[model samples]
Target chain A: MRSFIKLASVALAGLFSAQSWALNIFACEPEWGSLAKELAPEATIYSATTAYQDPHYIEARPSLVAKARKADMLVCTGAEMEVGWLPVLLRQAGNPRIQADQPGHLMAAEQVERLEVLQKVTRSMGDVHAGGNPHVHLDPHRLLQIAEVLRDRLMVVDAENSHHYRQRFVDFAARWALAIEQWEQQAAPLKGLQYVAYHKNFSYFAEWLGLQRLATLEPKPGVPPSAKHVQKLHNLLEGQSVLAVLTTAAQPTKNAERLARKLNSPAVVLPFSPGAEGAEDLYSLFQISIDRLLAAR
Target chain B: MKNISVWMAASAAVAFSSVADAQNRGRISSTEFNPAISLILDAGLAIYDNDEDYEIAGFPLGGEAGVAEEGFAINEIELVGSADVDDKFYGKITLGIHQDEGETELDIEEAFFQTTALPHGFTVKGGKFFSELGYLNVHHKHAWDFADAPLVYRALLGRQFNDTGLQARWIAPTETFLEVGAEWARGDAFPTGGSPQDGRGSAVLFAHIGGDIGASNSWQLGVSHLQADDVVTELGGHSHGGGDAPDNEFLGDVTISGVDFVYKWAPNGNAKQRNLKIQAEYFVREMDGEFEFEDAANAESGDGNIVADQTGWYVQAVYQFVPRWRVGLRYDQLDSDNQFSNVSFTGFGSADDLIEESGWADEDVKPARSTIMFDYSNSEFSRLRLQYSTEDSRHPGEEKDQQIFLQYVYSLGSHGAHRF
Candidate 1:
């Protein structure tokens, strides 16, 4: 019986020797999923956050539990953004591979330049964030760093496939840089234009495209703008020059209409996500949002 | 054709904005477009014991069809739609359908325009709206954590619904905080009288301020007050109860007035992942009116002077040991006084208002209720919840009891943003 078991083990080992599987990645956000797909084309991959929904309100279900239990590497948007559900998921996945302080566990927010970091935070504030906005994927200059950071982690998991992962990383990096140049040139025409935004979420994109964020529509953080505030904005418009009003996928529209009409400005929705509003892919998400912004102006 | 012209106008505007160095600079052309609309339909039937008859919130539900399921009932079918007008504004509409064994009902829930634009980090919003009180209230049936509203809500809100309001929310430039200003409905209420009812309505003014306390934390605090005139149900027949029951068995003129405070908090972080959230509310009310007594010996009193205090709160805590599995526990309770002093009405023989002057049923009463839910979350969009609840009705003594509930929520939607 011992000899038979040994023979079976050897055969199984031999079967996997050629492909040499490196790692299986479970990503909470689509950006990390994209990076993993680039670095390890052969590995199993699952992304919890879709391009369409808000990343903060993911529902926890059973199949996801089964997936987490088996994940070899887990990547997420930390900095309190995914705090809403990721912690619960991790505790339930119960896999030692991606538990905190483990090699396979990661909070992508810690891997890049953070914006909107607050000095002090308190619960009295409606959903205040401390480590800055976790929506860092919007910055292409940082996308390379995200990919590089992901590559290092993948390397440790599948040391045998290090070279393969490295090669994949280089190819993707080249393509990404090429795309950057193309996007910059295409967007140059609309640079330096002033626009109004409803929620502050699009600041990162605005910076990248050189759009001037003249003003925000929110009268108070988390507070809906009042009729009085809208009128105040109209008054502010008399002196401030702006092309249009901008907002995201889920913005309530009453205030926007008043502002748009008051200033004789058009309203536009830029893809607030990489591809969430349905432009097909990350590339299209950018193209789509920009197209709408310019179009609405 | 109207939409096409609008699209054309938008394209012309974009070309005008980006003419800095384009070959088609200011050409009034070169725009790719897609205008899509989305609709969400929510409907449900509830099986519970309640008496809407002879009451503003409950009377309509009970008196209309006599409770479809032995107090079990079908409440509403609401279809809400939003079509994007441009970047920051969208048009909204809500259509509602109600059902009872005897009659089917229809009404409009909300119809208005919504926007997300303000001068300084403000998201200005205006529209006929439902108040954003609890998590469940904001979402319709399919999205609820459970099939029914918690008992505390029903007891306090009269009806577990609120519609008609305007608000302005601002996300500080720092992006970690929010402040809100809201105005209550000018004229609207549950059990809306199809015909203009005689009585002055009420309005509420609300102020809310809140934000994240830490890296992964968030909370909100709000205060509101309402100015209510009097709620009067004119008796069509001789009655002697809450509203002059048939043959004089009605009560009269209940003035509604209240002051309330709400607070919520959730602590979050990286090292010791203890996810905890808690919310609490307190309400004070005084009802001034007259009531008819069931027993002739019992006389009505003008100083029925009703004074009461009610409170509700919930505490939920969860810990994530690893990705994909989570266990959570939540406890909530509502304690209130159901019985007010009896009323005194003059001119006997029990006609409308006359008979109601004499008060008090066979039993003495005080009611208090509570519920606890233990939940297990498996992923971002699914969970199984085990819940236990208890309530004490008007009779208070034997009517108070407990119950156990189990439910599952499975949702399918695209990803959403994190901060707000």
Candidate 2:
């Protein structure tokens, strides 16, 4: 009977050995999930929030907590973007390796230069991120910098895979640079094109493409657009030759549709991150966004 | 030479002012060290058939049991401050203010420090905080779907189990969500009464296990045990004969065990637009000891050896049918069985003699209630809710009381996410 028990225990341990060899990664958003996948293809990646969901607000399901508990590394966009949900998950997971100040914790925003950083913060400012806009992944230049930081983080957490991660980082950086140049050439016609947006979701993207954002549907950040605000956009469109009304996949399209109809312009829907319809990977995400914008124009 | 000196003076002033401007920018950029703070405001208007004196049947009024009057009232105002104390610990403080008996009172709801760097997947917390006994005890009131506490929670734990205590918990290194914890409390809350002898009155042990069912559904199950010693409880009820206060005193130990289950479903693992959650908890309490009751009319005391057992359970289901709208329904029931024998009442009149003869009821009194709620939230920070409930406990001839409440909750600043 003792021999049978010993053999059974050995079989159980062998079954779990496969999982133990792979690095378990928990990414707070889809952008980080895609980056982690690119850097460590052998790792088991779990994305907490999808592309079609607002990353600002998400429910911390038990499964998410469970994932965080066993994660070897956690990659996320910090600077208060996940201030609402990530802290609770970390506390509940009780994993010492992935705590805030640990080597396994990597925040992308901290590694890049943030835009629209505010000096003083108050509720009257309407949910403004004090660390500036956390939408840094939309800019390919910032993504390169964040990629380097994430690669180093993975090396520190999983030393055995340092060479694999370093090689992946070098290869990804070279390809990303080449793709950025190609995108720049293709998007030359979109420069200085005036457009209206549902929110300030793609400030970095607009800044990179040199597109001019004339107005926003929401009069204030984090607030739904009112009729008066939409009407103001309509009045502005009457005088200016705007290209399109731009919106993200996660945002509701009611205001965009209404504004586009009033102006007879196409409402351009862009993928904010990876895992959208045609943007299943990081490379395809930018290609689909640019193609949609160009088709709308 | 004079022309060259004048040019150098102008350049020096320009450089000095530029340096001062850079210093100002540096001061404004240093906001990283401040703690995260948040404030939540909840107020509502209520209408009820009860005349501010009606109490839920089979519920102890030791805690805040009375509801607001038929008018506008401030439900609660919560202020929270949290930050990492160091590399090894994190601290949080929550202050709650609410209107009670026409007076506003402030309570230190939770002030605790927890370890962040404990090895072996362990966490240790100390200070005054809510105990993790049942699924709902660790959650704040604003997180509830309905505007009021569930009937079972009110009867069993007095809304929450806030105590100054020490807790140690462990998260198992499993793929599934598995955790076990234990707490030693001062027992200044309900089910244990106020501070007992030496102030050590309650010990709680709990465990939870959860996992996902495929990709869209997740579920969790938990069990908890609370052992309270030497509970001197004052039963707040009316006498059967003369309508006077019964003032029954109970001196014994109480043991409560509970099990809770929660199931959630979100299509494609995206709950931004739609989701459904069902949660239920069942608890059973047993007490054994002496029960002494005062006879008001004859001014005599009756003593008996009483053994009582009580059970209560609540089940609620909430569905987010659309992005910003949610509806929920909840039902709860409480039942009690009391057995008393060898009662002796000396120098007593008719009322005292009647109480001594028939002190125990053969059948248990079961009280049940149901509530329904609907709410609309424009964002994660604000919500408007409307709720209605029917008290189904018919106390012989009393008509059923119906309640209506319209509430609004808005939270500003930074707040942590709620537990599932």
Find the candidate with the highest DockQ and give its number: 2
Evaluated on the second chain alone, the candidates' TM-scores are: 0.59, 0.84
Task: Give candidate 2's TM-score.
Answer: 0.86
The candidate scoring highest on lDDT is: 2
Over the stretch A91-203, how does candidate 1's per-residue lDDT look in tens digits? 43445566654446666666666766666654344444666666777777766776776776666656556678789999989988988898888778778888887756666
lDDT, model 1, position B64: 25
What level of docking quality does candidate 1 show? incorrect
* CA RMSD per model (angstroms): 23.1, 9.1
C-alpha lDDT of candidate 2 relative to the true structure: 0.78
Considering summed lDDT, which 10 consecutive residues are worst modelled in model 2 chain A? A13-22
Off by over 4 Å in 1: A1-297, B1-78, B96-99, B102-107, B121-124, B132-146, B165-178, B190-201, B230-275, B289-366, B374-386, B404-420
Estimate the TM-score of every prediction: 0.44, 0.86
| DockQ (CA atoms), all models | 0.02, 0.26
As a whole number from 0 to 100, the lDDT of residue A99 in candidate 2 is 88
What is each candidate's fraction of native interface contacts (fnat)? Answer: 0.00, 0.39
